[model samples]
Target chain A: MQQVQQQTTSDPILEIRGLTQNFGGLRAVSDFNVTLAGKQLTGLIGPNGAGKTTVFNLVSGFYQPSEGQILVDGVPTAGLKPHKVTALGVARTFQNIRLWNDMSVMDNIRVAQHYRLGYGFFHSAVRSKRYRQREEEIAREATELLEIFELKKYADEYPRNLPYGTQRKLEIARALSIHPKLLLLDEPAAGLNSSDIHELIRLIRWIHDRFDVTIWMIEHHMDVMMELCTHIKVIDFGQTIAEGTPDDIRNHPAVVTAYLGDDKI
Target chain B: MLRRYSVHLILATLGGLVVYLAYNEYLGLYYLSVLMFMGVNIILSSSLNLVNGYMGEFSCGHAGFMCVGAYVASVLGVWLFARDRVFGAPVLDPEYALYAFPVIILAGGIAAALAGLLVAFPSYKTRGDYLAIITIAANYIIISAIENMSAIGGSRGFMGMKGVINAMEDTIYLPWMPIWVFIFTIFSVWVIRRYVSSTFGKGVNAISQDEVAAEIMSVNTNKIKTITFMLSSGLAGIGGGLFAYILGYVNPGSFNILKSTEIMVMVYLGGMGSLSGSILAAILFTILLELLRPLQIIKWIVIPLVLIILMQFRPEGIMGNRELGQTFPRLKKFYRFK
Candidate 1:
């Protein structure tokens, strides 16, 4: 670490209060509230269909909560669209990798910087001096990101050609390229083998320490959650049941009943 | 720094040389007509390519916008330049007609772009098959609505555009229609090429691949769709204006669903998301239509069969969404028309 003062360090970057979501008649998430301090590494773990992903969708502005509010960096974002939330410095990766399959890996990373690019369509078409300078910067940034993920060698290849683990890594690299203040990883370790899970845990830890951002990940694997996340929030039946440090969450009664059994926890 | 404009300089010079040759009568009338139609097809296919190919929207009503453009451009062209049929001699002097031609075409483009917004707004709520149906219905609605308007000739169609061309010729002794068509075609292709190679264009590809992810990535999917549709429809309008000039008449029947399908075939055959492919497909398709003219009704059957074979063998189309610059690295030095 360079002993740099991160922008997200002092204040709570995300504050959710009474956030509730309903799909048709069924409540998918109800009265969900949590607060993440800047630079906190948090985990959201639940059993299958525990509405873990729903919370991610709500915070990222994919769904308007049937009720309640979400504030990011002190600004309310209840009815904002996903792109607007992203512009507010919240970036997320889907449970299933959603990389642009036809684009080259390098282009995938560059696409996330779509808003930050100051030039308009006319400048790009004419390839003006500002366009050239900005484009060079985008390329350099994308290359640097790829280098961090060990994907520099595969920059020209399409995402579909990458192996499973590498594809997952590429998605993370893409989300990071947005320079988000809050990073949400929805089941980041889903479908990975044990060795790959170990690699991912290491990567997530490195990201938490290296990047000047807060992280909240949804994981089904308790081992990964316990090892990587300093704070943990547990949800079941579309409601938050327990939240504390990983050790306290491991010993919580409601969490044990909802997800991890007494024996497993 | 100025070396980047060499490709544009070369293209401009080539266009001028062709116009010069046409003026000198070096090319026969038949060849001149063929070249003009090629230019028109290039505009149609390339503009449609923006929506159908790169944007990955199933827009079956492209000709609806074209119809709007054609009527708007033709009616204005005749109203200003050919007043003999309506009231008396031309209200606007023939001397000004040549200068006013591009403005008239641009007006047509603006009208068509407005019409495009009508369709684009519905796209925010619907997508894929539902949006396709909306566009198809839009095509029918435009044609039927125009056919019902007897003031502009109704189903019988509208004429008098030829008089505007004649007015221009009477003012200046030069082949103006071909020159203007060639220039507009090049301009349309140039603008679209510039658009697709830009960051905005890449947002289009991202939407096509995965829309939700693109939205989450801060790519305003709705804004991009609206802009792309408007741009595509506007260029189609310009092509339609050129088309009305070439035919010297505008008929509601000329821009039916079949016309839209024809453009769609060119788009798919050329390869989705490739500007060079659009140009190549437009040329080859125009030639194919001419070659098949002898077969008449059988040509329709044969054309669909050819498309079927193409889809079966090369489903991604001729260029497979890769631009010419990507296919041939050596061409990269010539221009970055990626």
Candidate 2:
């Protein structure tokens, strides 16, 4: 927990301390802590029911922290609504793909860019000159984001018609439109092929570099977890068992046991 | 682009055509008043559509807000017409009557917006079935509260504006309230359609699709909900205002749960999120209600039967949540050539 504090002060984008989430009688996540540095990818990996998603829920304001401190950019975030938290530059994607399926793909991205693209009442309501300019800017930005995700071809179509891989990328693209300081991806590569995984890694790296956004990824794919995350945190039964670089996490005795069940790493 | 401008102009021209057609063919006093009701219903349905269809929240208290608008508008009309006489003379000088109606209607919209703010506040914490219940409760509460207000005549109802209507008729031999209805109906439809297509309405759709995802995307769901709710309720208020003028009386019993259900039917029948769908449905609903008039009380049976058929064959309703332009893009394209 103290180390979580130190991380917040020294080279940290997000710091979680003494985090605990209990589902009725069950302790889904208890006394867990993780630190994500700026502009780097951190992987959160564990077996089923290891409370990986629950931790993300706590940090993202989907679920209030049961007993923990979440500091984003050194500001303690307690009791802030999800949108307020998002405005503070922390954004996330769900494990289940959640897109506005009925709306145009362009609309999905533009809505995300809405608060950022500011204008006045006459502009928006009466189609004032400023509002028109804002709309064009929003459209351009949305189109640009769509193009990057390789989804420009389907810009006019709804998300429901999009292929699974493209949908995932579009989700990421929508998140980036907010210009967040930290991005939390619940499971980017969950149901993707090796080819898709390759594309996702490149995209993630590209986002990290181009957008200067820190990423905290929760993924079951070992290869993705091992390859992308600059640092790794391993959780088991709601406790942090091992925490280090990918190689350190891979070699940690408890992590090896957690993965291989007493078999050598 | 200039092409978009031309497209807008063409749309306006078509709207003009619809108004001309309605006037040329359907302008008797009774039918004219019905046209006013139709316009009001269009505003109500489209506004409710924003919350129920576009924002995808189940709001069942539109009539309650409409009652608020009606009472406020009527009260203001009475007060202003009194000319410092306070509670006297519900109608002022004859020629100025048109001015009063629009003022009352606008006041009604603003008052309804306030009521919407109240309903919207609680919705921030809940959604789906629970919110629906709150809205329904709000509807009942508004009706009951208004019914309890003795100053407003309570359940007995109130009247004042007939003198204004009489004055207009005394001056102009062939005064038509339907003309006002047709124009305002056009105004209401055009405003809602354009609003929904703009960037702001994109937020409404975001709330419907995925609220959490929307917030994370930097879309302010709370602001959108609040604004959308107010706008939707305000439109319902305007509908009620027009309704009051059309009926020449105001009563709590008039805008009951059945009225809210009526608007809901129109919205769903038109397609949940479709603006043009609501208009089409409102018109069809009015006509169907009239056609079933011969059946008398049996019309209620036919209404549900049509709803059942709608659900079975095309649950999306007549327009399936699509606008006239969206449903038939070719219609829009054809007009655009001009």
Candidate 3:
């Protein structure tokens, strides 16, 4: 018994439509549409100038869409801030590796779980059993998150001391601390070494399969895109030019030109 | 996990020292006054530390809160001390005046906390240079408002704390204002040190690191600002309460922008997040000023030149955000018992 959705029947955990985003005079993203189904790893690929990160910003509410609709789990979130979007179960990492550099790695992860902590002064100051319990719970969770990202050895170390690749993994572990249903990773593999990128691809695939989360990642890595992504969306400047399996994205002439300078193919 | 017995051990040592000092009443008075100054500096640094160190917001108006606390406490002290004297008889006999000290200081703390609430609101709305102006404005407002109030010896200043001390002397045959000032100073430091290590305190540090991230993670930043401001002001008020008693006078002229600047200097010099740094700075700063006072006007030139030199080498100030124990970890067990 197949049911017809009033809109689309893709059963998307996240859906964006006609999202127009302007940065001062530049229309960074225009007529952007994306749908992410549950537990699917989707790639958002294009040339450097394409609106991939802009779309993440628009969806994350860092930049307000010039005009459009953003729906998370079928709920409209057109006018909201980043934290508000985060509260609605959409967590993101940054392209520039936005982290609390002075803080310990464990603190970075614990900070994300702040919303989950229910203890106030009465519970915290009085050392009530609940506070102690919650404290232990968060520590355990932070440890597990560190283990997942393979950053347990650097848990107590500050971000400034860690290697660049480890810092990026720490950033993802921090995002995972929020337990988001939809993860928006903006160029997670941007500056990773070859070995680290291999681990990242495996990790990203693992997270999708295990957590039942929909991952929408902006990346320029063809190998990562070809390896992990079930489907790919290709955009040029501000408009989507192609949407299909990875094979379709590879063959699309506009996406091809956007990357190779000219369609030699 | 820290124990009360550990606190008592440190207290007993300080208490033994205070007893030894009390044998010489004249020197005891000087020591008590210095101790009071040290306490005030602790409050100044610790509260400002909440903004400047733990919270990472630059504020320059500690003196304003001190003024607010001072006037409020002084007015209450005068009102209570005046008693039937308002009807021109002085309802509270001189003998009992010493006992009223705590009440007057509490009123000051509450009044200053209210004033702190005002500063906290504006702080949330602005940062950097804009916040600096707001603090400067607050300082001016407190000063002018105090000067305008003619009822309490406006510009010429007010006295009578000496009378209270005199009363206590008559009652107990005490040696120079008792040992409570030293006790309170130690207590203030201990409380702040303990609070800073707690969960609520970490939130302050988290805010200093990244505010947007803090809010997204549910740090309740606005509420923290309000509470932290109130707390710092309350501590400043405690300092004022002690200052009033120490000098045996209350004066608006003494609590000005310059005074606020002095507190700021102490906080920065001590190291923003370091409690022990402030405590040490307070002691050193007071001793430095006293030692330099013999140089009179020339002291200003030498001190500023030295400070500028110090700044070049240590931009984060003498302690540079590290606590005494952090800098000298070997002292941990002996220095802070708990």
Candidate 4:
């Protein structure tokens, strides 16, 4: 078994030290630790119900960790709410694609910037000059982001009407609109066809290089993880089983046993 | 920019025409009262729609906030501008009532907004039917609190607001209540439109659609919920203030569960999340209520039956969350809401 050691990065974007989570008496995640830095792309892989999402949920502040510390850019996120955590430059997408289905695509992108709206109820109610200027800037930025993702044509359409692949791309684009320092994507290729999967792989790689943001993804698809992730971490029953470069993880006996089970049986 | 504001200009002209008709006595007292009630209903439904439709919270105690507004505004107006048995002489000159009418209504709204915290705080943990139960209980609590206050006439009701209205008319020979109602109705709708169209306010929609996504995506769900409940209840308070002045009295029994249910019916009839839909539904519902006045007690039964049939055929309501412009695209050229 690989030892639980932190990555030696001088400037880490996300640092989790001995993070643990419990649902009643059941241990969902136990003593999880990881340090992601720079613009590195990492993969987290495990079987269903293996606490992969619980890790993302803990990092995103959806659930407070039972123990340990999470530092985003040197700030502890112990009691900060999810939106406050997002304000500190962390953004994420759901495994099931949780876009605001009723809102139009343009609004979906615009609303994600709610953290830095820089205005309030009175400004909006009175339509102050600052409110008007900020709104214009937000609209312009949203349009540009949509155009970059080639989603400008569907700007006025509701998200529910979009095809499955387009919806996934829109969700990723929405997360990036917040200008996150770290983007956590939970299975971007889960529901996409083979062609869409290829497009998504290219899209994610381009986003990593273009946006200068660290990416941490969770996926069950082996080919996508092998092709995209430079480093891989495998967990089973909420315990870290192996951690290394993707090639090393591929050859690790612990990971093989965790995924395929005992051959002697 | 000019094209964007053209709609406001057109509405202003329409408002001026109504005031002119009222001044010339072209519309009688009966018609004028109907028009004023329309304005009041418009404020009530649109405000409730902010919470129920846009924010997707089932708030059944809207009249509780309205009751708070009505009592606060009535007592303040009587104490400040009129002679009453409860409070000897007027604090300010009766003539100031004309100038301070808007202030009185706004004061009512602010008081109601503070009362809205009763529900907003609980909403942090509970939602859906649980929140609905809290709101319903809050409605009872507010009504019971006012009903037990013997100083304000309690169950018997309170009056002397007519003196305040008379003081205002004595200052100017205009139909002051109609004018104020029209102005505040338009103001409330304008504020709501501006709020919902802005990115900050779209957080309400985000919360309604998927609160988890909203919270994780940087929308402060709790703060948004608080602001929405306050704004919604505050506007309902304004509506209640107007209703009290129009009728020249305040009573706890008037702002009861039945009244709250009426406002909800108007919201559902209009379609949730559409300001234009709320306004249209309010106007139609008001006229329907007035027309069916002859039915008296039977009207309640008939109205619910109509709503039931409406639900069976068009469950999403008349506009189905689309604005007037979206329902009829030709209206877009004249003015775009966003």
Q: Write the per-residue lDDT of candidate 4 for residues A169-249, one digit (tens) a residue.
A: 999999999999999999889988899999999999999889979999999888899999999999999999999998998
Positional deviation of A194 in candidate 3, in angstroms? 1.5
Tens-place lDDT digits, model 1, residues B105-172: 98998889888997799988788999999999888888899999888889998888888998888889
In order, the first chain's TM-score in every candidate is 0.93, 0.90, 0.90, 0.96
Q: Estimate each model's TM-score.
A: 0.94, 0.90, 0.86, 0.97
- Rank candidates, TM-score, best first: 4, 1, 2, 3
- Candidate number of the best DockQ: 4
lDDT of 2 by residue, B1-338 (tens): 55557756765685566556554655466665665677788888888998999988999889999999888877776655533233765445646666666766788989898989878998888999999999999999899999999887889886665655565555664344555565567667766666777787678788898887777676677888888898889878888877776787899998899889888888888899887788888888888777788999887788888888989999988887676777688777544321
DockQ of all candidates, in order? 0.66, 0.60, 0.32, 0.86
| lDDT value for model 2 | 0.80
Residue B193 miss distance in model 2 (angstroms): 2.1
| CAPRI-style class, candidate 3 | acceptable
Candidate number that wins on lDDT, 2 or 4: 4
If both were scored by lDDT, which would come out higher, candidate 1 or candidate 4? Answer: 4
Residue A140 local lDDT, model 1:
95
Give the better candidate number (2 or 3) by TM-score: 2
For each candidate, what is chain B's TM-score? 0.95, 0.88, 0.90, 0.97
**Residue A221 shift from truth in candidate 3, angstroms:** 1.7
Give the per-residue Cα lDDT of candidate 2 at B305: 86
List of clashing residue pairs for candidate 3: B84-B90, B84-B91, B85-B88, B85-B90
Model 2 clashing residue pairs (backbone):
B271-B321
